[model samples]
Target chain A: MNITDLDTPTLAADLDVLERNIDGMAQHCQQLGIPLRVHTKTHKVPEIAKLQIDAGSQGITCQKLGEAEVMVDADVDDILIPYNIVGKPKLKRLTALVQRARITVALDSEETAIGISQQAIADGCVVPVIVELDTGSGRCGVQSPQAAQRLAQQIMKMQGIDFQGIMTYPSNVRAKPFIEETLNLLSSDGIPVNIISGGGTGSEAASKEIGCTETRSGSYVYEGMTRVGNSEMLTPERCVLRVIVTVVSTPTPERIIIDGGMKTFTSYPPTPYGHIIEHPDAKIYGMSVEHGHVDVSECSHRFKVGEQLSVIPLHQGMTSNLHDKLVGIRGDQVETTWQIAGRGKVF
Target chain B: MNITDLDTPTLAADLDVLERNIDGMAQHCQQLGIPLRVHTKTHKVPEIAKLQIDAGSQGITCQKLGEAEVMVDADVDDILIPYNIVGKPKLKRLTALVQRARITVALDSEETAIGISQQAIADGCVVPVIVELDTGSGRCGVQSPQAAQRLAQQIMKMQGIDFQGIMTYPSNVRAKPFIEETLNLLSSDGIPVNIISGGGTGSEAASKEIGCTETRSGSYVYEGMTRVGNSEMLTPERCVLRVIVTVVSTPTPERIIIDGGMKTFTSYPPTPYGHIIEHPDAKIYGMSVEHGHVDVSECSHRFKVGEQLSVIPLHQGMTSNLHDKLVGIRGDQVETTWQIAGRGKVF
Candidate 1:
C-alpha cells in the first residue's frame, strides 16, 4: 500500500530517514568511543529496538519494567530500566524480567534498593542496579554526591544486588563536575563503577565530555519537532515520524480542523502540538479531543476538505504511545507496518 | 483480583460510582424529556457502552468510523458519529459500518457531504447526516445559521442522503439563539428536522432549554476532573475513573515522583494533570514521559516509596485512551476488567 491509501490520522515512519538517523547517531557515538544505549521508550516497537541494537547500540534502556518485558519478548536480552521499581507487584514482574534478560534498574533511594534486593533474593538471582543522580533534570535521582555514595553503598551491602555505577538523563554540561566528584568518591571508597551512562538526544554529542562511558538517546531515531528546533544535528527533513492527517473542515477563513488532535498527538507544552510540514505559517493554536484547530490566516495557501497534511509531533515519544502501529514509508510507499508492542505499557 | 494486587500506573473504574453516574445522567435526561445518546469516546470500552445503553441511553455516539466499527462488533446497532468523514478510504469503512448499524454522520461542508453521498450512492444506501452548527464551540461546524442552512440544503438535494437536522458540542447558553434560528430556518424551508441533538456532559442539564431533542454526554458515565469542577451534578466522589499510581521517589522535601505522568494522564490545560484523592494539597506540577512530578510541600501526609495514590484525571477521556483495559473496582475488589476496544482506533 502507498501513503495515500492508508487512513487519515495514522503515524508514518520514513524508513529512509529512520535508517539514516539510526546510522548517523550510531556512527557518531562509535566515533566518539562512547557506547550508545538506545532508549526503547521513544518508539516502543521491538523491531525498532532490535534495529538499534543491530546498528551498534550496546543495550536498550526502558523507563518501565512493562516496556522491558516487551523488549525481552522481542529477543532483546540486555535492557536497563532507569526508574525505581516500587511495590511487590512491580518488583515481582521486574524479577521475572531480570530472570529472562540481563536487566539493570536505576534507584535513587535506599527503600527502593531494599525492595529490589528482597525480590531478587526471593527469586534467587542477582539484579544489577545503577544509582540515578539528579545532576540537573531535577526530576528523579539522588541530589548530592554523598547521597549517591550512600545509595551505592546500600546496594553493595544488600544481598542479591550488584551496584553498577550511576546514570542521569539529559547529561547536561552542568552535570560533569558532579558526576566526576561522585566517581572520585566511589573510587576512594574502593567501589568499582562499571557503567556511567548519561545521555539524551539533546546531549548525546557531549556525553563523552560529561564523563559518560555509555550514552542513551531515544529521540535520535525519530527526530521530533522539538529536537528539530533545538538540536543542531536534526532538521525537519530528518524527522522520520509524521502524523498523516486530513483537513476535515475549514469552518472559517482563519480556522481549519484536522482529523488528529490531543488524542492523536501529545498535548504537552510548547504551544501547537505539532508543526504542519506543508504549511509553516499555519499554527495549530488549540486542540479538542478529536479536532486539531489550526489557524491558517497567515498562510497564503488554501486548504480544501479531504486534503492530507503531514504533521511532525513536538514530542515523538508521547505521540507514538497514542498510536497502535507505525507505517514505515520509503519513497511514498509503505514498506512495512510495525506494531507498537510497548505503546501503553506504562506500568 | 483486587485493586492493590494490580500493577502500578494503571486505570481503575469504581463500578459502584460508574453505575451511579450512568444512572444519574440517564435519569436526569429522562426527567428533562431529552433522549440521551451517550458518547462512547470517554470510556471506549464496548462493555461500558453496553452498560450505558442498558441504563437507558437511546443510542451511542462515536467520534470515528473505527470506533463505530468496534461498537458495531459489540452489537450496538444505533450509532451516531458527530464528525465529518472525508476521503474514500474512510468513506468505504463508513459505508460498511452503515450496512451493519443505523449510522448518522455530521457534516458542515458541501465537499464532505458530496464525498459521503457518492459513497452512499455507490453502496445503494441512503445515509442520514446532520448539519453541524458552530454555536460558539469554535471547533467544528458552520459559523452561522445561513451556513448551516446552506449545508442542510446541499445535503437535502443530494442523492442517497437523508438530512437529519443539526447538532453542536457543549451546547453553550449562547448557542440557544443560533440553534433555534437554524431549526426555524430549516422548518420554514419545508425540510423536516427530526433530530436537533445538542449536548455534552457540561451542557446536558441545559440541553432542553437549548432546544435539543437528544443530548449526547460522554464524560457523564465517568466524569473527569474538569466536569466535576464545572457541573453542579458531579462531585469528585462520583468520578469513577482513577489512575492508581505508586510514589516511586521522594527526591526532596517538596518534590515527589509518581509512576504515572504524561503517558498516563492528559497534559491538556488547567495545570496539574490530576487530583490526588487522599491529598488535595499535593499538586502534580509537571510530568515527564513516565514520571509525574508532584509538589507536596503543603500536604501533612508523609508519602513513602511504594505508597499508592489514586488520581482523578483532569480529562478522563484522553487518559482512558492511553490504557488497554479499565480495572473495574467494586469496594476495593476488581470485579471485572473491561478491554478498551476502541482505545487507539483514532483513524
Candidate 2:
C-alpha cells in the first residue's frame, strides 16, 4: 500500500532535498579530500548507507554491534565501530564481524582493549583497533594523547590486534584545534596516527580542516534539525523521511491534535520536534503515544480538523529508531519502502 | 546469555519485586470490586499482560494498534485501544483484530468517528467504540458533556459502529467530581454506558469512589514514581523493575558515569529518573547516548569505575519501552526471559 494512503501518522521524506543533502555532503568532503564515513546510526538503514557509499562515502560507522550487523548484511564493506564493546557477548560478536569484513573497533581503556585483544587472539584474527581519545564530548575516550599512546603500546604488545588509529569525537569547532594538538602529541611520542578518524555531521568539516582522513556524517545523509543547524552549505535536508500525521481532534480553535507523539519522535525538548510542513506557524506543543498536540493558537481558525501534515523532526537519528519501516520517496512519488533493518536492536 | 554474567553495562530487572507488584495491584482492585484493566502500553510484552490478567486484571488496554497486535498475538482475550486510530491501513488492521478477540477503540472527535465508521462499514464489521471524555489531563477527549453527547449521537448514527461506552483518563481527584457530573449527563440523555472506564494509577481510588464502573491502571502493575505519588496503596511497585548499569568513567573525583543513557532509558525530564540501589546519594544528573552521569561531587568517594548499580527508575512504563528483552528474576535468580514483543511498535 502507498504510504500516503496508509491509515497511520508518519514522517515522510522529500527526495529532491534528500539527494541534494547526500550529494552535497559528498561533494564538499571530496573537494576537501576527506573520506566520508557516514554514521549508520543516523538512518540505520542499509539502503541509505548504500546510497551514501555509492555517492562516495568511503565506508560506514556503526555505534552498536547490532547496527554493524545490519551494515554487513547490507553488503557494505569497511565498518568502523566507535563504541567500546564491553563483555564476552559483544566481544564475540565483534570478533566474528572482523572475520566477515574489515572491522575497526574503538577502545578507551586497557581493560576493554585487553578483552578485545583476547577475543581477536582466540578467533585467530587480526582486528584493527583504534584508541578513542577525548577531545571534548567527554562521554568516552582517553583524556590525553599520552594516554592514547600508552593504550596503543599495550595493544601493539597484545597478540592478534593491530593498533591502527587514534579517534576522537570533538565538541563541534574544537575538532580542529583539539585534533591538531592531539596529532602533534602522538607524533612527538613516536606513535603512528594512521586512521585519525574523528568527526560527526556537526564537526565533519572541522575535522577535515585539521587533517583527519575520515569524517562520519550520518545525519547529513538524512538531514535532521541538528545537521541542518550545523551545515549551512547543504540545502534544507529533504529526504523521503517525514512523520505523516492526520489531525484527529480540535478540542479548541488553538489546540488541534495529531496521531504522532513521543513514541513517533523520541525526546527533542525545548522545541517540540518535527516541523509542520503544511502549516508553518503550527508548533507541536507536546506529545503522548497516538497523539501530538499542536499549539495552533497562533494560527487558530486556519487549520481544518481532518487535514494531514508532514513534520521535519528536530532530531532525525533517534526518531528513525522509533519506526520499523521507511517509505522512501522520489519527489512526491513513492519510490520504495525499506524496513528499518535492525531497528529496535538494543542488544 | 546470563544477564548478570554479561559484560556490557546492562539494565537488570528484579522478578521478586515484579510478582509482588502484580499481586499488590490485583488485590487493591479486587478489594474495591472494580474491574482492573491493565494498560499494556507500559509493559508492551504479552507475557506481562498475561501475568497481569492471571493476577486478576479484567483485560488489557493498549495505547497503539501495534501494542494491541502484540497482546492479541499472545492470546490476550480483551484489548482496549485508548487512542483514536486513524488511516485506512490501521482501520483495516483493527477490523482484522475483531476476528481474533474483543476490541474496543477510543474516539474523541466526529471526524475520527466517521473515519472509523467508514472503515468498519467497508470491512462489514460492527466495532464497539467508547467516546473519550476529558475529565482532566488536557490531552485527547471531548471537553464538555454537551460535546460528549453530540459525539456519542454521531457515533450511534454512524454505519458499522456501536457507541457502547464512555471513558475518561482523569488526572487527579478533581476528575472524580468532573467525570461523575459528566456521566450523569450521558445517563440523563438515555445513552447506554456499559463501560464507564476512568482512572489511571494516578487516580485509582478516586476513580472507584467517584463511581467509574471500570478503572484502567497500568503503571500500578509495575508501579513507578508517577503512580506512587498518586496511589498510596501500591507499595511493592519498587520491587518490579530495576535498571542495572555499570560505571564506565569517573571524569572527575566528584562525577561518575554509568554506561546506560537515553538508549537504555527514555529521556523524560523533571528529575533524576531512578534511585541508585547501591548508592543512596548519587543522582543521575544527565545522560548522553552511552553514559548516564551521576553526580556524587559533594560527599564521598564510595564508587569507582566499573562498579555495578541497580536503579529504581522514577518512570517504569517508558523505561520498559527502551529495552528489547525483559529479564524476569526471582531473588537474583532469572526465571524467564521474554522478548519485548512490541518494542518499537509505532502504528
Candidate 3:
C-alpha cells in the first residue's frame, strides 16, 4: 500500500531519509573513532536496530528491561540498559535477559547494586554493572568521583556482579573534568574501567573529546524538530519519521483541525507540538486528546476536508512510543511495515 | 496477583472506586433526566464500556472508527462517532460498522456528509448524521446557527443519510443561547431533532440546563487531577486510575527518580505531570523518556529503592491510552486484567 492507501493519523518513515540519517551518524562516529551504540528507544523497532547494527553500530542500548527483551528476540546479543533496575520482578526479568545476551546495567545506589547481585546469583550469572555519574544531566547518577568509586567498590564486592565502567547521559564538554576525575579515582583503586559510555544526540560530537568510549544516541536515527533545531548535522530533510494526518475540518478561516493530536503526537513542552511539512506557515498552537488545533491565518494555502498533511513531531521518542507500527516509505512508494516491538514496554 | 507482582510503570484501576464513579455518573444523569452516553476514549477497554452500558448509559460515543469497531465486538449496538469520517478506507470500515450496528457521525461540512452518504448507499444502509455546532469549545464545528441549518439541509437532501440532531463537546452554560438558536432554526426548517448531545465531565451537570437530551462524559469514569481540580464530584479518592511506578533511585535528598516518565505518564504543560498519592507534597517537575524526576524535599516520607508509588495523572484520557492493559485492583490485590482493545487504534 502507498501513503494514500494507509489510514490517516499513522506514522510513516521515509526509508531514504532514514538510511541517510543512519549513515550520517555512523560516518561521524567512525571518523571520531568512538564506537556508536544506537539507543533503540527512539524507533523501538527490532528491524531498525538490526539495520543500525549492520551499519556499524557496536550494540544497542535500551532504557527498560522490557525493551531489551524485545531486542534479544530479534537476535541482538549486546544490550546496555543505562537505568537503575530495582524490584524483584524486574531483576528476575533482567537475569533472564542476561542468559540470552550480554547485559550491562547502570546503577548509582548500593541498594540497587545489591538487588541485581542477588538476582544474578540466583540465576547463576555474573552481570556487568556500570556506575552512572551525574556529570551533568542531574537526572540519575552519583554526584562525584568519590561516590562513583564507592559504588564501583560495592559492585566489585558483590558475588555475581562486576564493575564494568562509568556512563552518563547527555554528555557535554562541561562534563569532561568530572569524567576525567572519576576515571582517575577508578584507576587509583585499580578498577578496570572497560567501558566509558556517554552521549546523547545533543552532545554526540563532543562525546569523544569528553573521553566517552561509546556514544549512545537514540534520536539520531529519527531526527525530530528538537534535534534539527539544536544540531548543524541534522536538517528537516533528514527527518525520517512523519505523522501523516488528515485535515478533518476547517471550522473557521484561521482555525484548522487535524485528525492527530496529543494522543498521536508528543505532549512535550514548547508550543507547536509538531511542524507541518507542507504548510510551514500554519502553526499547531493547541491540541486535545484527539484533535490538533492549527492556526492558519497567515498561511495563503487553503486546506480541505480529507486532505492529508505530514507533521514532524517535536519529540520523536515519545511520539514513536504512542504507536504500534511504523510504515516505512521510500520516496512515494511503501517500503515495509515494522512492528514497534517495544511501544508500551515502559516497564 | 498483586500490585507488587506486576512490573513498575503499569496502570492500575481501583475496582471499588470505578464502580462508585460509574454509579455516581449514572445517578447524576438519571436525576437530570438526561440519557448518558459515555465516551469510551478515556478507558478504551471493552469491559469498561460494558460496565458503563450496564450502569444506565444509553449508548457509547467514540471519536474514531477503530475504537467503535472494538466496541462493536463487545456487542455494543448503538455507536455515535463525534468526528468527521473521511477517506475511502475509513468510510468502508464505517459502512461495515453501519451494517452491524446503528452508526451516527458528526459533520460540519457538506463534503464529509456527501462522502458518508455515498458510502452508506454503496453498502445499502442509512447512516444517521449530526451537525456539530461550535457552541463554545471552538475546536470543531460550524460557527453560526445558519451554518448548522445549511449542513442539516444538505444532509436531508443526501440519499442514504438522515440528519439525526446536534452535538458539542465540553458544553458550557454560555453555549445555551447558541444551542437554543440552532434548535429554533432547525425547528423552523421542519427538521426533527432526535438527539441533542452536549457534554464532557466538566459540563455534564449543566448539560440539561443548557437544553441537551444527552451528555457524553468520558473522564468521569476514571477521574484524573484535571477533573478533581475542576469539580467537587471528583476527588483523588474517587479517581480509579493510578500509575504504579517504582522509586528507581534517590540520587539526592531533594531529587527522586521513578521508573515512569513521559513514556508512561504525560509531559503536558502545567507544573507537575502527576500527583503522588502517598506523598502529596512531592512534585513531578521533569521527565526523560524513561525517568520521572520528582522533587520530594518537602515530603517527610523517605522513599526507598523498589518502593512502589501510585500517581494520579494530570489527564486520565491520555494516560489510559498509553497503556496496553488496565490492571483492575481491589485494595492491594489485582482482581482482573482487561485488555485495552482500542489502545493504539488512532486511525
List lDDT for all candidates, in order.
Answer: 0.88, 0.75, 0.88
Q: How many residue pairs clash in each candidate?
A: 0, 19, 0
Q: Model 1: per-residue lDDT, tens digit, A25-51? A: 999988888899999898999999888
Candidate 3 per-residue lDDT, tens place, B1-347, comes to 87788888889999999999999999988988888999999999989999999999999999888999999998998889999999988999998999899889899899899999999899998988898998878899999999998899888999989998999877788888888999999999999999999888867778888888899998889987677774333345778888999999999999999999888887765668787888888899998878999999999888888889998887788888889989999999999999999998888
Clashing residue pairs found in predicted model 1: none
TM-score of chain B of each: 0.93, 0.90, 0.95
Which regions in candidate 1 have their CA more than 4 angstroms from the true location? A230-235, B230-235
In candidate 1, position B307 carries an lDDT of 89
Predicted model with the maximum TM-score: 3
Model 1, residue B285: displacement in angstroms? 2.0
CA deviation > 4 Å runs, candidate 2: A1-3, A171-191, A229-240, A300-306, B7-11, B171-173, B176-184, B228-239, B248-257, B271-273, B295-307
Candidate 2 is graded, for docking, as medium
The DockQ value obtained for model 2 is 0.49
What's the DockQ for every one of the candidates?
0.73, 0.49, 0.79
lDDT of 1 by residue, B1-347 (tens): 76877788989998989999888988888888888999999899999999899999999999988899999999998999999999989998888888888999999899999999999999988889998888878888999998888888888889988998899888877888998888888888989998888878867767888888899998878877667674332345778888999999999999999999888896666667787887878988998889999999998988888888998887889899999989999877989989999999999
**Model 3 lDDT, residue A124, Cα:** 97
TM-score of candidate 2 against the unseen true structure: 0.92
Off by over 4 Å in 3: A230-235, B230-235
* Cα lDDT tens digits for candidate 3, A1-347: 67887788989998988998899889989988888999999999999999999999999999889999999998999999999999988899998889889999999999999999999998999889999999778899999999999889888889999888999878888888889999899899999999999978856778888888899988989987677773232245878888999999999999999999889996775667787888888889998888999999999998899999988888888899999999999866788989999899988
